[model samples]
Structure formats: structure tokens, C-alpha cells
Target: MAHTTKLNTDLTGKTALVTGGTKGIGKAIADELAAAGARVIISARNAPSAESTHHFIAADLTNAQQASSLARQINDEFGGIDMLINNVGGLTTPGGGYSALTDKHWEDELQLNLIAAIRLDREFIPVMTARRNAVIIHISSIAARQALWNLNLAYAVSKSALNSYSKALATELASKGVRVLTVSPGATKTPPMEKFIADYAAAQNIPEESALAQLLQQTGGIPMGRMAEPEEVASLVHYLVSPAASYLTGSIYAIDGGALPVVS
Candidate 1:
């Protein structure tokens, strides 16, 4: 008889920095990494409304000066981290397609969803290159592939750019003992998503449940029949960043519950 046991995902000596880690998928990822034994640090423009175990730093990543200051502060205080989760993106622009979107709207969307991560990576990758087995995870979205132009034109385009950037960065760093990967989650039940649904329902004068159904249908209907829990996405991220997934890199891992119709 052979004995079998669970693989250890312990990150006892590793340090992790999760951007926008105060809430939603970022919060879930931060919590999961901490549980896996990593010393976690979270950053956002504002402090969390609720108390948390992780150290919180205030920095608006959209600003280059603030981002540089944030990196310097972290390197000074914590000696730099082994893991970087670029999870500080959102749909901050309005809907109504390209006609309604201005140059500023597109620029703001890119700043939040794409450029912030790029700046942070530039600041951290030098230190990370000197370390052994460092990881960078970009929290992307399914909209990168199946974009809904009417509702998320600018945001989706930004994520598409992010996905491309992640792949390129991963390739460049593959020989440097650093891993870079992207996690694309669809229809996650986060606070912003819930609010989007609520607002949509009000706009259409329909019940919340009906609005949800319609929205899902527009996205080709999830085979799982519901939005993914934030922790579910976190679990996948935990695996990818763990030592158990040492060989994985330069890939976009989708956690979309079969919502994407095409096989890529």
C-alpha cells in the first residue's frame, strides 16, 4: 500500500505585496496568501474601513510619484517582497460604448487597469531579479477576450493590454528565476460587481435576479450558473504562486466558469 498526503503550500519565509488589497478579490488574495504563511502587505489609495491583520499602506498607484514613493517605502520598511499581486484595477469609466468615451476616459481607464501595474513592476522587478523564486501575478478579467463594448469598452481594452503586457514580461523574466502569470476571472461576486448589477436593475426597472440573468445571458451564460466567489479565484492564485507550481509561467489562467465560448 502506498500512502498519500496533501502537498504543502506553505510560504513561511516569503513576503507578499497585494495592491488594492483592502477589499474584493484583492482582499481575498491577501487573506489567502497570509494563510499560506507569507507575511502580507496591502496597498490602496485609502485605508480599509474595517480593521485587518495585514499591514496597510496608502498610495494612489495611478500617480507615478506616489507609486515610486510606495515602492521606496516598502523596500525601506520590509526589505522588499517576494511576491507582487497587481490587483489594483477596476471599471472606473462609464458605459455607452466608444462614442461616449473621451480621451481622458480612455487614459484614466488605462492608468488604473494597465499602467499602474507596469510602473509597480518596474520598481519591484530589479529587487525581485536578485532574489530566488519570486512571482508576479496580474489580476485580469475575461473581458480581455470577450469584451462587452457597450458596457465596458475602455475597461476591457485596458485589460487586453494588460494581458499582452503580462505575457511579454513573463517571457523576458523566464530565465531570471522569476515567474509572471495572469489570472482572468469572470463575473466575480465583488462589491463593485454587485453595485453594477444593482444599478443595471434600477436602470431597466427590473428585479435584481432578472437583471442578473439578463446580464449573464449577454455574456453567453456561465455554465456554472453563478458568479465566482472571490476566494475561489484566490485559491487558484495561491496555487500558481506556490512552489508546487514552479514550472508554470507565461500563461493566462482563466477562472471564468466556462463563460468564454471559444477554446484558446
Candidate 2:
């Protein structure tokens, strides 16, 4: 018998904060949450060139002072958020193995990917703990498990640290009303990914399609034979943070289309 189960994803009274929400996966998440009736607020270093429906705050979260100010502003303006999506991370270092990376490169990667989320969680976890049914999601990458040493060394290391931190935090907050989880997406079709492909193609003097194929081959290829759409990742996140996912916590959810060869 096929039984239909309706998911309670309604966020009519909830507020969400999505960092780096002006573009890519973060933007998609903000849009999806907004469509699901959440009051979404997005933060980035700069405002978007075009206007958007979601509230935008110019904040460089990599800076401790800026992160604190952003948190204070959100608490004052929105009375603390019900959902915190830590999506303000990226691969902002040079490629070509460990030697190509310097101390500054490692520091930058960790600051952007791991420390920023830690600071934000520190600011909002108290507020979330005080309230009932709060959710905190950390947007990670499959690179945490499968690293292309020449390309994403520093970035992958940072995400690996983030994964560990998320699990520990989730365990600590499990008894509290807050739910903390990590969402790891593999090779999603986002603006940054497209640009990465294009740049690779140009550098290798090959077509973009070939560059993409080579990159996929490096990652052992996706069994699904394609990259995930940003919306698809957003949909999974929506489910994880929704009321229907109340029992799910203290784990890493992979949206990688079976790209991971071994079971995690």
C-alpha cells in the first residue's frame, strides 16, 4: 500500500538568517525558505546589484567584530531567528596541493568556513535555546570526505573541521530545544561552480564540457551522471530544518547523488 505523508514545512511564524544569501546555494535557500513562508534575512559583505524581497544586511562575517554586530542587529530587529543557516563559506585559496597554500591561505580558509560559523552559533545558540523548536543548519561540502588534494586542499580541510564541530554542537544541544545539523552537497550547479569549470577549461585549453568531465572523473564520477541543482539542495535543507524533521539531529546529511563510494 502506498501511503501519502504530508510534510509540515510551514514556516509562517518563523524567522531565518541565511548568510551569503545574495548568490548561489545560499540565495536558493533564502528563496525556498521565503516561499515556504519564513521571514528570511540574508547577510553578505556587500549588497546585491539588484533588489530582492528578502532583507539584506551588509556584513563581513569573517571579521569577529562584524559578526558580533550582525548578530546583535538581528537579535534587536527580528527578536532572534528561529532558523540559522550557516552558508557563508567558500574555496578562496590557490590550488596545487599543500605547497601552493601558505599560512595565510590556511588561516583564511578556516576563518571563512569554520570560525565564522562558530562565532555565529555562539551568538545565536543562547537565543535559540531559550525558544522552543529552533534549527541550525551548517552548509558543508562532500569535499570534507573526498578531497581533490591539488585543488581543494585548504577548503576541504576547513569543511572537515566544520563537520566535526557541527556534530559536537548538535550533541550538546540535543537535549535543548535547538536542533543542529550539517548538510553536505556534492558538485552542485551553482554560480561559483560554473565559474570554476570555466576557469579550469580556460587554463587547460579545453572545452568547458571536457573540463567538467575531467573534474567529475577526479571525484570518481557521480552515479547520477549529473550535478545537483541548487534548488534540489535547498529542498533537502528545507526538509531537514522543518517541523517534520524534529527527530533528525547530530548527523551529516549528504546530498551527493551517491558520489561517496563508501557508506559514511
Candidate 3:
């Protein structure tokens, strides 16, 4: 038999560092963690655009030195991380086809989606290992399984690498008491999706609804016929960090509205 999670987990004195937590899914996760009584440090290249801040540390993750420095700052301020969420990532361009993308595009995509997380984790894990209890969550994308439509070659490849790294890290950390988990979200209702729908509508001179319909058909229609809200993905992350999910580790959870053709 299984049970459900409760809101009373009360992480009152715990500290967490959430990369890219300024907006979208990252912002949602930061809010959930804060509501459960944790003190969260949200980091981004600029001052957080959203109010995810109980505290904010600006850092550009594209450089490994900055990532290491940010990790050190977190250690100095919070003592050590109890939870770490690697959420800084995005598609580098709209070039939608492989040939249209250049070497620079691939490098940029990989830096943002895969390499940044690895750099930060290298700094974070050792700090957490000393504690004997901690959790790290990586936000991946559905392209990790099915390819991204057209010109997102680099983005897809980066996510695939991220998925592989996340699994390997999870296995290596379990015995040390740090749980690493990953979430892959498809067609989520983040700011980027809104822009995609709007732009496609403009390009085709169709209503946004129609454009979204055609877009869904081109990819694979979500059985639920709607994109997931950021909060919905955050809910799963919340549980994975909670004691309730202590037995779960080294797994990838896809929250894609049943868009994948096969069941895992």
C-alpha cells in the first residue's frame, strides 16, 4: 500500500539553494519549499525577476568559476545545503532544424542545459555528503526520450546528457545519503510556451488556439490536450525532497500529460 504527502513536513531550519529559481518551474519549486518552512537561496545571472527570494545570489553559471563561487557562498551563508535544485537551462535558439543550427548554438545549449548543472553539482555534492542527508533535483526535458521537433538538435542532446548524468549521480550518492532525482516536463505552460504559441500564430496568420493545435499535432498531442502548469511539476519535486520519498532515488519522472507514446 502507498500513502500521500502532507503539507506539514515543516523544513523550518533547513536551507536550500535553487539555481534558476527566479522564474517558471524553478520559481514554483522555490515557493513550495519556502511555504514548507525552509529558507531558500535563489540564484540567476541577474537579480531574480520574480520574488522567489527569501535571499538571492546572482551568478552566471556559464562559467565554472562562478558556479564554484556561488556554491561557496551558499556554504558560507547557509552552513551547507540540505536541498539543491539544478534548474538553470533553456533552448538557445529558435532555429528549429539541425542544419540551421551552428557549432556555437550547440555549445551554448550544452553549456546551459548540461554543463552548468554538472559544474554546480561538483561544488554542491561534497558539501552535502558531509551532512549524511540531502537531496538534489535536476529539471530535464522530454526531448531526453523523444527528439525535440526540428532544429533543437543541441537542446535535445544536452538533455540526453543531463539525464545520463542525473542517473549516474543518483546511484553514486544514495549510499552517501544524498538523493538525486530528475523531472522531465513536456509542453509546460511556461513563458517560453506562450511565446511559441503566439509566434506560430503570427507566422501562420491563425488564432493562437489553431497554431497550438497544429503544433501539438506536429510534435505528439498530449493526451490531456493541455500543457502542465509549473506548480504541477513543483508538486512532484516537493514530494521527492520530502521524507515520504526517501525510498525513491536514481529515477526520472516524466510529467508530460501522457505525451510519450510508450509507458515507462
Candidate 4:
């Protein structure tokens, strides 16, 4: 007989902000948090579906002005947030060796993956610290450690910086009653990943399955034989931000399927 276990990851009165929460893993996380009874606020460059129940805000986080406006709107509308999820990042640069990346490429990657989170965190840290039990989660990638330079050189470097920043911030805030953590996911089954696989297949003139296999092999392959679902990642984020994880802070919670070859 199989037994089921229930998790205690409730966030009834929590107000949370999820940047890049319009779709993909971000949407999954926003939905999961709302289901746990939190008042979820989602922000992205585009609008969410009309059927979306969570409050939506449109802002390009890369722009300082837009980011500031976002913070103002959230503060005015909801006072402040109890949790922050910095998920607004991607591999937007062309993939090649060091020579392929220019100064702009490196700057863009850092702004999106590292500096964006740092700025947003700075804006809300005051209120979060006052709450004394707030949580800040930086959604990084496994590429931070296991970088495939040919595919995502700048992206990987940015995420590695993100991990380092998150650790230092966690240490600084530990005595101030706030928690900072990093969630590093391996290849997840999101719309972006699907598109990437499709593109690779087209570029290589191979079947999509073959393209996926090759891509997986490049990352040392996920031992679970599959990529993680967006919802699976969302579940981990929900747990980390919930009261049940009160003592958990300053750690990188990896949701990869044992893809990282060595212990971190």
C-alpha cells in the first residue's frame, strides 16, 4: 500500500510579489502561492491572461524607471509585501565562447539576472525587514554551477553571481529577521525550454527527440531521465517561502533531477 504525505506550506495572510510571473515557471510559482492563500502580485513586461486572478503589473525590470514605478504602485496598492520572488531572467544572449559575447551581452545578462534582483531587493528590504518574518527568493539556474559555455556563457556567469549575492545577503539579513534563499532549477519543462528544443531540432535538421537528447547530454543529463515540470519547481518555492521553512535560510535549494555531477 502507498501512503500519502501532506505538506504544511500555508501562507494565508502573506502578500507576495513575483517578478516575471506572467508565464512559464514564474506563472507556476505565482499560482502555487495564491493557492496557498497568499495575496499574490505578479509583474512582467506583458500582461497576464484575462482569466488570471492574481493582481498584475506590467514593467520591464531591466529599466530603472519601470522598476521604480512598479515598486511605487505595489507599495501604494498593497502597502508592502511579505515575500519577493525574483524570477525575471533568461538566456537572452547569443551562445558562443568568450569571444562571441560583447560588453553589451555581458551587461544585459548581469542586469537581468543579477542586478535586477539586487535593485528590487533594495527597494523592498526596508518593508520586509520591518515585517521581521519575510522571505526573499532568487530563482537562479543550475547553469550557475554547471555552465555550458557554448550555449549560455553570459547567462551562466550572471546566475553564478546571483548565487553569490544571495548568500551574502542572507548572511547580512539573518540577524535582521529576514530570510534570503536561492532556488536553482535544472532544465525545467516550460514554454521557453520547449521552444529551445524545437529551435535546436530545426537548426540541426533532426527530430525534436534527438535534439532534446543531445541538449540533455551536454548538461551531463538529468539522472531522473526527464526535465522537471514548472509545477514541481513551484512546489519547492512554495515550501521555502512558507512558515514551515522558518529556520531555512541562506541555502541554495536545488530542484534539479540530480543533474549536477558533484556535490555543491
Candidate 5:
């Protein structure tokens, strides 16, 4: 096995919690953090299977009550949350756009994408701040800025709000000792990507590969000519949580294969 590069930060005593961490980018993030030495906790509506060696908590974020309760549980059981990856979120309707989405659709997207992250931050980050050192990284997306997928406009919009929410939350927590950051990855080759491609293929009457091609084309050709694997995104999450990133906060770090056109 390849040696795990010793990261600058050794979370020897830290407890990390990753929301929606059962699979995909969230799972990857949790793994990376764990490998860096933090005891990782994966939370979702359903308990995350032990694909590796992390603890799992089942609590849905769509319900505000549940989000708060989960935070309390984290504090009680984990001895306070040192790191949190807010990763649960997605588009509610496959064909949703400006007119196709209803109020309920907006609510669901907002609840899952934006509110969930904020709820955790509001409920738990304060405890971390009191402890004097903690990290909170919200798993954001390129869709937050590009607004490229017409069919996923709602997803994009919800992420846009999450982007803003993360920044604002960071500013609020800056003086209090918590660091909130963002790691936005573009079309990663996760299980969700396969489903997204399959759905696009069926909806557009194209082959799955063609739908994948469409995704690349939409991103103006992922300069690297491939989607990122989950591990690559995980590496960034690992670094952000490590002491290597102590000075960082309120920044959106994009690992999008140079797909975003301009610098902000």
C-alpha cells in the first residue's frame, strides 16, 4: 500500500462529523479526514454502512428538528464536534427549472442544501468555538456559481444560497475561534454522477456516454479532460481540516478541473 502522506495537521484527538457521509464525496471526505488521524463520524437519514472504520449516525437533515437534535447528539456522544462536513443536498426534481419547480420543491432544496448546513453551524459550531479550535467545511459545488444546468437550476440556486450562507457564517464565527470554509468540486465520478448521467441519457434520448460527453462539453471541456475521482476531492477536505489551513476561512476552493472561467 502507498504510504499516507503525513499531513501537516495531525488531528490526533479531534472528532470529525460528516453529514451525508455514507457515500460519494461525503464518504470520501470522511475517509480523508480519518486517515489524517481524526476519529470520523458519518451522519445521514439512514445509518451509513461501515465501508471503512468510522462511526455512523442516522438523522435526516430535511427536518429542522432532526438537524438540531443531531447536533446535540454529536455534542453528547462525540464530546463536541471538532470538524463538520455539511454534504447532504441535491435537486428535488430531475426536470426542474424556473417554471417547473414548485414552492415545495424550493423548500426541499433549501432545507436540504442551505438550511441543513446552517442549522449545524448554528447549533454546533458555537460549542467548537467555545473549545477554541474547530473546522467546518461545507461541501459546495461548481453549480453554485456557473448556473449551467438548466434542468438543475433549483440545485444551482440552492447551492448559490449555501455559498452565501457559508461565507456569512464564517464571518460570524471568525472571531469566535471556528473556521468555516468551502470545497467545491465539479462533475466528480461518484455514484451520483452515474445516476445523473443515466438520467440525462434517458431524458435526452442519448447514450450514457453521450450524456457524460454533454456534461464535459457544458463545463467547456474539463481542461483535464476527465471528471475528478472522489479521492481527489477528499484530499482537499483533508487539508482544509488539517492545521495546514488554519489561516483559511470564508473561501470557496474549487477543484473543478479549471472549468470555472474567471477568478473571483
Candidate 6:
């Protein structure tokens, strides 16, 4: 007979909502949570490229009205959720330091990366607080700390703001039975990241491998010698939102493979 070990991460009877959950890290989290026995719902601006088992809702979280509608629908249908994953952020701004960034560029990045999550949190907080224990995961980027000016200036600033906001919110909600935390992942192998590297290689007239190396070098290189898999990030998030992590809150957890030079 084979012996089996059980993990404390079982989420039976819990409901979860993952923003930008159609692809990349968001999709990974949605799948992981569902596998752990949670009823999962995913929201994205557009439909997924492939079929998904989780309940799908179309909502561009950057739009305030759509964010509100998404929350309303979830409440009306599922009553509420135990886990909320704000995973809809990205580096949409162009490279080239502050001079290359316009006011609109800054606004767009902040709106998507920070404000959208804040809006959703406000909408769900009341419901979440009423529950026994609720968790909110903010998906940030390692760029928040070691930003490459010519690559992700506006995006980095927005994520940094999100970090501060997450900590403060966690402090405020701790007594209310809600937990808020930030997860900052370094370079992960995803479709958008692959596209970014391919485009960079084409623009620089270099091979894809070289392009990846240059980008990693700019970030001080991952000591692990490779980028993270989306599933790996999902695993960390799974633990963070699980019963095992009930005591954790108000901190930025890095899944950067030692790419972030600082000790924080």
C-alpha cells in the first residue's frame, strides 16, 4: 500500500475570484485553487484563447463601472468569495526612463496596476470582512524594487505604489478578519513575456537567447539561472491564501529566484 501525505492547503467549500484570470499567472492561480477544492471564478477583458473549466466573467477591471459590475454579479450569484486575486497588471508603457513617459502613460499604468485593484478591493471588502477569514493577493512585479528605467519605468512605479497600498490595507483590515498581501514575481515564462522578448530581439537585431540574457543581466540575473514558471508562482499564491498562511499578511513576497539584489 502507498502512503499519502495531506497538505493543509485544502480549500474545500471556499470560493475564489481571480482578475485577469484567463491567462498567465492569473490562470495558473485559478487552476491551482480549483484543484485544491475551491470554486473558482475568473474575470478578464476578453475571452480566453482556450477553453477553461472555471466560471468566466468578462470585465475590464481598469474600468470602474465594469469592476463594480463584476463585483455585483459575483455577490448576486456566488454570494461572495473567500479569496480575491488582483492579477491584472502588466508593463504596458514604453521603455526609455522618465523622459519617455507622458502623463497619460503614468496614469494608464497606475490605473491598471494600482487603481483597478483598489477599486475591486473596496467593492469586496464588506463581503469579505463578514466572512471568517478572507484573503486578497496583489500580483506585483519585481520591477517595483529593481526597476530598469529603459524597460519598465511607469510599470515599476505603479507596482511600488501598489506595494505600499497593500501593506496599509493589510494593517487596516487585520482586525476585521481580512488579510491583504503582495506577491512580486520576477521574470516568468508567459505568453506576454515571450512576445516581449521576441519583439526586443527583433528590435535589437539579436537572437532570442541573447535578448533574454540581456534582459536578465539588466535585472542582475536570476541566481537560479532561469525564469520562473507560472505554476511556481501559483504554488506560492496557493500557500499564501490557504489555511496554512492564516497568520501571514501585510508583506511583499518575492518569487524572483534571487534576482532582487536587496534583502527585503
lDDT of 1 by residue, 151-250 (tens): 8999999999999999999999999989999999999999999999899899899999999998898899999887999999999999988887888899
Query: lDDT score, residue 150, model 1?
Result: 80
List the candidate 5 regions with Cα displacement exceeding 4 Å.
1-7, 49-51
Taking every candidate in turn, the Cα RMSD to the unseen true structure, in Å, is: 2.8, 2.7, 2.6, 3.9, 4.1, 3.6
What digit string (tens of lDDT, one per residue) describes model 4 on residues 1-264? 532323568899999999999899999999999999999999999998657999999999999988989998998889899999999999888766899999999999999999999989999999889988899999999999988878899999999999999999999999898899999999998888898889889988999999999999998898999999999999999999987788889999889999999876
Q: Model 6 compared with the native: what TM-score? A: 0.96
lDDT of 5 by residue, 168-242 (tens): 989988988889998889989887778888988998999999988987777677888788999999988888888
Clashes of each: 0, 0, 2, 0, 0, 0
Steric clash count of candidate 4: 0
Writing each residue's lDDT as its tens digit, candidate 2 over 182-242 gives 9999999988899999988998999999999999999999999999999999998899888
lDDT of every predicted structure (CA atoms): 0.94, 0.94, 0.85, 0.92, 0.84, 0.94
The weakest ten consecutive residues by lDDT in model 4 span 1-10
lDDT value, residue 172 of candidate 3:
95
User: How do the predictions measure up, each by TM-score?
Assistant: 0.96, 0.96, 0.92, 0.95, 0.93, 0.96
* Model 5 TM-score on a 0 to 1 scale: 0.93
On lDDT, the stronger of 4 and 5 is: 4
Stretches of candidate 1 off by over 4 Å are 1-6
Judged by lDDT relative to the true structure, which candidate is superior, 1 or 3?
Answer: 1
Lowest summed lDDT over 10 consecutive residues: which window, candidate 1?
1-10
Q: Could you tell me the C-alpha RMSD of candidate 6 in Å? A: 3.6
lDDT for 136 in candidate 6 is 97
Residue 65 lDDT in model 4?
Answer: 87
lDDT of prediction 5: 0.84
